[model samples]
Target: MKISHLQTRFILAGILLVMTTVVSGIWSAWTFAHLSEVAGRTIQKSQLTTDLSAVLSDALEREDDALLLAMSGDRGQAQKKLDAERLRFAQAFNRLKENLDQPDQTQALAQLAKHAALYRAAGDVLLTTVAPQDAFRWYYQNVNPALRRAVAACAEIRESNFRAMQRAGIRARDDARGATILVIAISAAALLISTLVAVMLARSVLTPIRELDRSVEALRLGDFERRVEVTSRDELGHLAEGFNRMAEALAEFRRSNLGEVIAAKETLEATIAALPDAVVVIDPDGHIVAQNPLAKAILVATKAQGAKIVDDLPFSAGSLRAVREALEGKPTDETRAELTRAFAVRLDGQPRKFMLTAVSIPEFQPGRCGAVAVLYDVTDFARLDELRTELVAVASHELKTPLTTLRMNLMLLGESAGNLTPRQQEILATAAQGCHELASTIDELLDLTRIESGQLRLSRELVDVYPIIDRAIISLRQRFEDAGVAVQVAAGHRPAFVLGDSVRLGMVFTNLLSNALKYSPRGGCVSISVRSDHNGRGPGVLQIEVSDQGSGIAEAFRERVFEKFFRVEQHLQNGNATTWGAGIGLYLCRQILEAHGGTILCHAGDNGVGTSFVLELPSPGTVEQ
Candidate 1:
């Protein structure tokens, strides 16, 4: 028979259920039949035994009454009554004898019949006697004893039958109970087995359906190689076979298009190889998927000796961070900004510079998305920049000695005003001022060069930052007064201490104070405050803020204000002449503070009146006594 999977399962389950029902029904019927036989036997035995006992008792009573009546009077009437009672007793005894089944009951019934015969003979003798006294004596002596013997025998037979019936009834009840228990146990076992079979069949059917669903999902996700496994010859098995065929066809189609894909990949590799820059493609997990020859050469040459390319590459930590960001789907601009910096690597014991660029590639499957990095070598440009800085430093240093000498000569000329005209003295004064300004600009340029060259070293000592701030304010007091700006110093009660070069730290405060004085309006206030705090980064930090009530710096220029030679546009509303400084003051301040592990930030002052320059310096650790 060509049974389907569903039909096969249903047939097995139905067979189990039907077998349980039929077996239980048969067992119940057998038990009921046995119980009915037991009950019928019990009832029959009880009725017969009861009739025998009642008839024997009535027969004895009737014989006693007849004997009493004959002894008193009316012998004929007594004789009739006795005959009627004997007839009834014989009928009951015969019926009891017919019902006797056990050996003991039959023997007891025979004995009872013998005793009844003797008792009837004794009664006949009493009826035939003419002497009334003799009849009475014979009835008492023979008939009474025989009647008692017959009654005892009848009781024994009835008791024997009743005991046998009781034993049969008990056996019947126990058999019925055992049968019911067996049927119930078999039914429960069948139910459990059927349930297990149904579950197994259900899993078999649903398993194929789930496999088909998974296969379809795999195909949708571009996995054409997935195939459904067929383990049966039923309808589900046929479906699995059809699915496998479809997957094979799709796989073949993919193979046909795979040639073009491989060709394109080779072309891309060739293009990347032809390029001068080093290029590497990496997956989302930071694994290198592909790399051009230049990239391989650079990474291999720059890696530590004996390190595998797969384990460690030559990409800088910053470059890797940019690639990771790209892989994480950050905007291209943000990734580019993070990567647009110079990376230095050692190649053949020589330093080489490269600029890294990371780009994210959109993926058909999001899980397969990755990034590509390109490294452009800029060693020559870096060398050129270094040379330019050195040249500026040398020129500034050379001009310093001559500019200092010129300033001293102008001061001497101004001092000897007695031998010259007032106009000549004024000219000397202006020239002296110009020489001073020139020297200051040269000094600032030299400081910038030193900082850039990494040649600046600090003479560190534990110093009070408050005094340094005070000294800077005192030095700038004259300038502050000349600008008609009030100078307020609000040093906190607690001393602020830091580990730094006193002169360099003072330079930071001086630059900030000078800018405040220069930019403040006439009669404006410039406040300098110092406090001790822990700025969450660490414990024990010294903070100094220099605020000026002047035209606040525009937000657009705030970031650029610390760049060397950058300046803010002057507005006519201020009615102040354009201030002159090399603009390196704040730049130098930033460099100096950073060298000492501190930070400087500028923001608009309260009420938007001026700019606030905040300095944060790490406080010196306390020494144990």
Candidate 2:
């Protein structure tokens, strides 16, 4: 129902066309009518003049005949002929005067009358006075020639009027044509003007609509900065102006919202800073962007600002190297390197051990480019760690002495009881078994401390990873069979050798295999996959993937699962679940991997329903010696 510019233009053109056509038509009609009347008058004049010329010619001929007869002395014939010609000439002259259409036409008719009367009178005089012969000669020579000349002049005047009328008709036709052309030209110009106006109006309407559309689109895309542009005072322009106002309102709203978000972010940062941990943020290029006060304190104490780990603090070189390796790039397993925390020697004291828990900062914004390093001051934890080491050391020594003495005493008691009852032998055997279990517990605890403190000495060498894997499986076979758990080795075609301590590597596999068996259901599969890095340039790194069907670690706890003493409540529920470990097991595994420039991580298993622990070790040249 809306009226478009084209329709408006069409209506205007129609109006102009009708007006021009009607005006031109009326003008042409009037001109044509006037030209017709003028043409009729010219025709009448021409006919009258043509009639007078004919009559005069006849009169002159008759007069000449009469005059000739009289000159031959035939008076009766001359008189009779003259009288008849006079009567005929008078009738012709009367007809000529009656046919004249104008007053000027009457003047030519009067001249014709005078000429005719003179010729008649002259003929009569000649008949009576000069014996008709001399008079007749005079009449022929003078009156007839005068009549012929007067009649020819009259004919010329009529012909001139006729020519004028012809020209007038031609002029009328040309005027009508020119009027029609003028009408057409005017119509064309009117149509062109209408078209231009219509186009301008359409643009006026469409431009604002398009601008509004673009503004809405930008708003949808989360850009609230756009506004509609309007240059008119029409309704559409008003709508555009309204749209711009709305955009400004929305922009103000967004600004207020963003201000709140910024405030909240600042509050969160402040809270994080208040904590005892030293937190730092790094750009993608490994440059530190933000640091909490604790970090600044540490940096000032060490004078290591703006310096890479390995370059700035040589005494703490390994510690800085570990931070770089951990936080350099992608999300990775937490890297823990042992370092010493130094204080000013106010009382001549040595530096203290502070366990460094360096974890690879995950990319907060998936595609954006930055990293975060949370530095927890584990000084107290380190002290506890040292206490645990000393306890293990002390307990090992103390338990060894008791275990050795108890074994000897149990052997003597069994030998003495050998000669007595079977009850005594049974009691002695039970006592020896108890002793053995207690000793084993002490040894396991000691091993955990040694791993945690980073004091576990390793003899690094090139050794095939499969033998260690095979040994682990064999060692844990009885435990698996007893629990009805199936254990198998999944290996690649080529041998995979790793530059690691075979004993420690075997222990890592054993710990993992034991966990897999304890957590898996009866007859469930515990697969150990081993392979070598295919490319030859790098070290022939070995990968060991241990998979088990068990309760999966929750997404939130995946990172925490490797922390020391960390245990999920579910894993501790089952009565026979040895999987609920001292939590130092996986921690030790990580520490051992880091020691050898290798890595380990826990993930959703192949079936995506269970857990898989993947261990990656340096091949050869890729290992940091």
Judging by lDDT against the true structure, name the best candidate: 1
Name model 1 segments beyond 4 Å from true.
5-26, 29-44, 51-55, 74-118, 128-130, 166-235, 282-289, 300-352, 357-373, 387-441, 475-490, 493-495, 513-587, 597-619, 622-625
User: Per-residue lDDT of 226-300 in model 1, one digit per residue for the tens?
Assistant: 999887778899999999999899899889989999999889889988998888887767677777776777767
Worst 10 residues of 2 by lDDT: 339-348
Mind giving the per-residue lDDT tens digits that candidate 2 earns over 1-625? 4443445645765676666567666665766676678667656666666766577567757866876687778878987887787777677766766665555556666665666567656665666665543654676676667657655655654665466566666876786677677667766776676676667666756777887888899988988888777665556667878888888898899888998999998998898679676666665556666777766666655666655433343234444555566655544444433322312211124343333444565563464455555656565666675776788788787888878898888878777884867887777777887786566556666766676555778899988777888898887676688889888786465466677899888878987887787678897889888766647664456677999987777776776776766776544445454445556677677878888889898998876767899999877632222
TM-score of each: 0.72, 0.51
Model 2 residue 156 CA deviation in Å = 6.3
Measured with C-alpha atoms, the lDDT of residue 373 in candidate 1 is 82
